[model samples]
Target chain A: MNSITSNVFGPAKSINVARVLLCLEEVGAEYELVHMDLFQAKEQKSPEHLARNPFGLVPALQDGDLVLFEARAIAKYVLRKYKTEQADLLREGDPEEAAMVDVWTEVEAHQYHQALRLIMLECFLNPTLRGLPTNQAVVDEAVEKTKKVLEIYEARLSEHRYLAGDFFSFADLNHFASTFYIVDATPYGSLLDSYPRVKAWWEDLMSRPSFKKISANMTTK
Target chain B: MNSITSNVFGPAKSINVARVLLCLEEVGAEYELVHMDLFQAKEQKSPEHLARNPFGLVPALQDGDLVLFEARAIAKYVLRKYKTEQADLLREGDPEEAAMVDVWTEVEAHQYHQALRLIMLECFLNPTLRGLPTNQAVVDEAVEKTKKVLEIYEARLSEHRYLAGDFFSFADLNHFASTFYIVDATPYGSLLDSYPRVKAWWEDLMSRPSFKKISANMTTK
Candidate 1:
């Protein structure tokens, strides 16, 4: 049995789960991705998983007696534990570069998450489950906001190769996950097409061996 | 000149600034707090302050040549730079304990920030500035969500003394700022009173020498 087990759900459909899986691939660590049945609410709310993650969320990682949840945290832990030359790929040695990584990661958590989640809720969750009226105004507002954030990325990518400077860090991975979702779901998906720098950035990220490896094996339910 | 200089606006009554101040006090670092004239739109949007924080937010920190704008990030850096006993406070010695600290800090960033910001906007910002009708429904929903989050904290506090366990770390300080605002502004304020464990937990936090120093010196705009 693998020492590290990642508990995930909703198929390979979830960007959050993809984050940890991709990080594991980046570290070249042997781990098992355990798919949880979200429909049955079985794996998530199970007593064992609850002990690992009180929130009953997927993408929880367990290593021996240490249990960790939150995709970014797990990614950082894996990188630190494995201590690869790819350290610069996730975090830099310099404090300034590290701070830049923190900044973009926060950007992912706050702005990107905010815009992407709203678009997802409007497009999929509300339409199928919540029975809420679709507000074009809200959707437009989200698109505009997402465009503004992407413009920030576009400008940054114009100057640097990756989100956190010259290195292809997990910060890039974080944005890739959210932006991929945005392109799939939002009307503003075409906005990335206009930002040539950002388009190149995405293309380069998707070409990574780790991303390709994990994403290829992903099971979409 | 002091090593740290912070631009303050949006009222010294801001929980965000309070968090930074608490951290500065914890590290016993000398700083100059310049009150931004928020009413006149003087400090936040001023070219100088905007350079310090592109988001035009208050509590931007300048440490010599390296300037950081986010309050939480600044607080973490302050502790890291000044505290000799970092391992004890931040749980740095053991990977498991350190992971717990990191997880709770992420929780502060993800869950606590969302709930607090929503309540703040609904309770204060919309009604006061936007001339929108105070949406009790929005605020009530936020309160309910906050209650669930606090319930998690309550259970944790029942077993441990602080948010990250027995150690009185910055996790408590990070939460103190937001929770202080919630206690003052919401009916959920009374909810904390019911959780004797949480109440005891908070009391211990407030009694910290750092908390005392920061609270005493806070200038209310």
Candidate 2:
């Protein structure tokens, strides 16, 4: 058995780390999650960890010599590696559906992440860190911009059950991790409330057994 | 043989459209390119095109019932469908290499695009249409931001030939498309000259027969 070692410096409360843990649950994979203390600047910036990830980010995965960073990439790798029976998780039998899923994943990585990062930086990181100030103008612009992007999702979910059509794929899970984090922190939480279809979709996704397991794991730390 | 249709708008000089064309060449795939007259504002915002892409973006691909937008997604599809011998365009063999490629592509789509778009809007799009005068400060800031990013690439390429190591993958291609376009318009054109390894790598890529073919096609239109 090729064992995988996941080194995560983030708290279980971190949405980025939760994205990976949720992916493991979806794939039913058993792996070690080595928790690193971000407060102490322990494992993440350590020379060993930096060797694995030059960026010194958390949620780095190691399978023998195959060490990878990036939460989305690691999530996709887990899905591809473990979920042979779960067609909806990674590869789709229908090319079109698969492409749609890819599109949503890209959206999650690009537009969704862009908005979410700005909000997170303002609400959490910026105040405590060495970056730009959590200015109201920047936050407002981010919220407005994010709402515009989410409107597209709102329209899509109005017609379909999931972000990638009917299938509750990892794509939906990925978006949920980031979106729910922003909603949890920002006043723009009501944005989803206005989009009933998206709200329902969120509720449905969070209710999934895999989501439950991952969410439980997140709170435990 | 399945027929594919790609909607390419803006001027023939558009960098985004060139990305798609380059992908087609890499995959050795044949497709019909439908040029949308951006001046007339005719084809891009047309109802049919809008149906394929809600964002009303150019370089949307259509294959039978499958309609795909987002240039990266379309390029990935073309590579998967037509490229017989997978050359690790996105680093196929090793998990780490693949993940690195994926991360760089994300960086390109997210961070690099953000900076480059600012430059483009100020330098090319706004100026060409006689809109607001170009913001020199914004342009300068963007160039600095983009150069910092290139420094990361330079550091990586100094140690390894391509973005994802020795292999010339789609990650390199993605960066090439974005950087080449920005360099064409910026005083930062000479910035690339500072990174000898990256310059050599890029020169080799630009000299590829496939790249040559695509560039020729791009100019003739």
List iRMS (one decimal) for every candidate.
Answer: 1.8, 2.1
* Alpha-carbon shift of residue A132 in model 1 (angstroms): 7.0
Candidate 2 per-residue lDDT over residues A66-107, each given as its tens digit: 777767777777776665665348554455666777878777
Badly placed stretches (over 4 Å) of model 2 are A36-46, A92-94, A115-147, A216-221, B1-12, B38-43, B86-97, B110-126, B129-144, B216-221
Cα-based lDDT at residue B8, candidate 1: 34
Encode model 2's per-residue lDDT on B11-74: one tens digit a residue: 4456677777778777667777777776566577888888887767777887767788777777
Counting clashing residue pairs in each candidate, in order, gives 1, 1
* Model 2 CAPRI rating: acceptable
In terms of lDDT, model 2 sits at: 0.71
